[model samples]
Target: MMRSLGKQTVRTHYQHIVAGVHDPEHDHTHETRQTVYERPDGTFQINYMSGKRFVMATNDGSFECVHVVQTVRSASGSTIMSVIAGAQSLAVNRLNAVIEFESGDRWIEIEDDETARLAAGLTQTAVGHFYHEEERLEGRHLRRWFVLVGPSEDLAVVGKVALFVLPPHETSVDPEVVDCHIAGYRNGNPYPEFAAEIEALAAATDLPITPNYMGDPVVTPPATGRTPGL
Candidate 1:
């Protein structure tokens, strides 16, 4: 599952490893690789890194070792459309929204009254103001949509979709965190990049996209399918 504050609170243990080697067969020549565990804390401490290359041989076979360390987070909010709508109510105008998809494309939707209202009240309280907070009120016109993703029954892929919501954003970022290691993978591996795309898209709009782990977005033109009115 994607790391979020909510999940971290309930289940705090997590481990991920990404390794790149020149040859798989040669790398696994040894019957076992050394495993070490040290001081466990909220932070990840890199125990070591190998600067020299060395070989080893037991009764087993010729072997080698590499040392490394990395950090991980176990934590997790918000909608863009409502913020746009609230901005409109605050007499802010000329807003545009760009939602980058998990696939390398974007779905752009123009906001109307209803859509703007959906997006408006979704903004957080501490951030309760565009210009200022004391004047804040809900039910402003704004546009909004949602994406829910989880493991599929088959367990090979993640399930995801984009849907419109009638309510304002009700979610909050989680506070829990855990240490983790991320392995390098193929280009298709979704990680930091998906989150990065959203950051770029947010720049196009007057709205602010929180820096969360939805990963980087793949921006493209807006979706082409029929969409319900805002």
Candidate 2:
């Protein structure tokens, strides 16, 4: 289970070590002492390095994910600090995955592999907005197709599962547009089975189905494959 803000209020202190330091007159080692206070209602505070402080709070529990990144630069004592908050951890994971994927070869070959293709499709559905305008539009269109078929709880599950199986920093289609180009045959009638396959794949991989923000139960598919009139 993902980390949740529960009734486990605690305070802790630790040393964060920074490696690979070379100083002419010093011992060539450095570490920072940090203190953290976590509350049961998902609020937390951190203090480090001469009164520098970071804090986060949740009111109605809309936000659940938080990430802190520290970057060190070679140029004359340069450092960067970043804090990110999200509604769910999956979004943050997918963002990290996209970043890693983009930092390397953006293009890859799907080679008619069904699983890879499916993964690509789900990526398009989920984070395609991170891509260029054309590719983002494509993703929007595909999402529209799913919406037209009527909203199902499985849609989000399939999307998250696909993201889990996707290769790090790689896409089988054109990296420029981040296009998956799923076949037309799989779009309309076969979508239910397609969704089922994705769920099965996720189960095979032991990927947990992320609960909705409200923690609702999963529902069955609607009787009609396509939404009425479209």
Candidate 3:
């Protein structure tokens, strides 16, 4: 040891310490609906529910916008059939194919294959039906109607009439526009009384009416004497 005193060595010891800092609680209920952003590219994107960004795009670098006016979901949240049904209801029309006239006070409704497939996925019944009849000396009239009886007891009737516009004209209830206008019925029965509303809707969006008889005709009820009551 004395002889080795000329050579000396140094040693050091290091110890590590770890600790966690307490974090404040957050109120998730205070969170607001995620805002959709319009990108510089003229496209809109939103990350909604489960990290899915529903995107709408345009070919000309224009933005596609959509306001989700409604939503439906199953209690388990795993079954989105109701939402699909609602979406289909919003986008599909009464006349996806040719109309077949059936005679009777009761009409047998039939939907096109595409409409039927979409409707079938959401409900246990027909997506909708078509009723038609011919006049003695006049042309035939067809009415396409959809009846959606809600799980919450709400009832809705969706009707689309076909019309004839002149040459170089387009059909009313064109499948594309029809889907967007379908939301109009969500407020009330899409009947003759809603003609003004329909016309307004059509005018605002430049939607053309079909070239056939697709709109409801206004009919005034006949006057009658008051019935005697016991």
Q: Scored by CA lDDT, what does every candidate get?
A: 0.27, 0.28, 0.29
Worst 10 residues of 2 by lDDT: 142-151
Provide the global lDDT of candidate 1 against the true structure: 0.27
Q: Model 1: residues >4 Å from true position, as ranges?
A: 1-104, 110-137, 142-193, 213-230
What ranges in model 2 sit over 4 Å off? 1-55, 62-194, 199-216, 223-230
Candidate 2 structure quality by residue, lDDT tens digits, 1-230: 22333332122222222234432331122111123455565555443322424344447422222222223444555332111111222332333121112112111212223324333344323222222222333442221111111113433312322222223343434232222222112122233433443333334334343221112222553233432110
Candidate 3 structure quality by residue, lDDT tens digits, 90-173:
554433323222210011123344543443233322122111111111232222333222222331212232222222232333
lDDT of 3: 0.29
lDDT of 1 by residue, 54-171 (tens): 2222244323344232223223222332334345434322333255444423433424434333222221111111112112222342324332222234222221222222223432
Using lDDT as the measure, name the better of candidate 2 and candidate 3: 3
Q: Order of candidates by lDDT, top first? A: 3, 2, 1
